[model samples]
Target: MAGSELPQEALWQRVAGRREGVLATLGPDGTPHLSNVYYLADPATRILRLSTTTGRAKGRNLLRDPRAALYVPGEDFFNYTVAEGRFEVAVASVTGEPAIDELHAVHAASGAAGDRPAFDRRMIRHRRMLVRAEITRLYGLVHPAA
Candidate 1:
């Protein structure tokens, strides 16, 4: 089957429906550090949110260099979307204030069931941070089964 661009809404739906993606950030050696991560997409704003520890390579690389790339898989191998742009790394926090709060928002948006307080505590214990990117460009192809 011939592949073509997915419609805007369909593209957003493809992105928003899934949580896993590969995030690419530039490492100190000028190499791409790709990480498999869970992300929350605000399709309306073209913003993506993710939680990470400050010490992780992806998080550390992102903090050092804001530019990044995201690849979200489609329903099958033939369909997928990529979002690319600069990202902002929120300050790592252990106070359960803004950083943990941002993580809470990401968790809530994901519709995952869990204890909020315990989640907050875990986030704090792990030196969690929030990563955000407002995509400057989006492109992908969709090929539905015949």
Candidate 2:
């Protein structure tokens, strides 16, 4: 992981373009909780947004432990980036408050489309939440594992 390192800008750029990654949160027992998640990156703020259900392990883990990391793969097995960050969870709103709005933003960022009201209802029904990870550091290999 310590050879030719990618500049911070390059890391952020890859994050913004990568569609998905493996998010690792800490379980109650301090073990690693991993989940394959779709994400949207804000390179300007260094934040990554993702939507999930409260019932999911990742959601619960983030609520308990804000520390998290996202493993973003590159075009091939040789390349990858690991983004370390802290989480900020926003619960799903039942009455379409700012929480729902933020969730919608995340949905939109993912290029998903649907009826607004219906989406809000589903978000509430599923106890959906937005998990924003403010990335603190980026590291990984950008070359072949060999």
Question: lDDT winner among the candidates?
Answer: 2
Computed on alpha carbons, the lDDT of every model, listed in order, comes to: 0.82, 0.85
After superposition on all C-alphas, the RMSD of every candidate to the true structure, in Å, is 2.3, 2.4
Model 1 scores worst on lDDT over the 10 consecutive residues at 91-100
By TM-score, who's the top model here? 2
Residues 1-146, candidate 2: write the lDDT tens digits: 43457988888888888869999999999999899998888768998888999999999998888888999999887788899877899888675688788778888876773678898988988899889888889887676354
Model 2 per-residue lDDT at 103: 78
Instruction: For candidate 1, write residues 37-133 as lDDT tens digits.
Output: 9898887887889988889998889888888988998878888998887699886456557767778878777675267678877777777779988
**Which residue pairs show collisions in model 1?**
none
Show how many residue pairs clash in every candidate, following the order shown. 0, 0
Query: How many clashes would you count in candidate 2?
Result: 0
Can you tell me which runs of candidate 1 are displaced by over 4 Å?
Answer: 94-96, 108-118
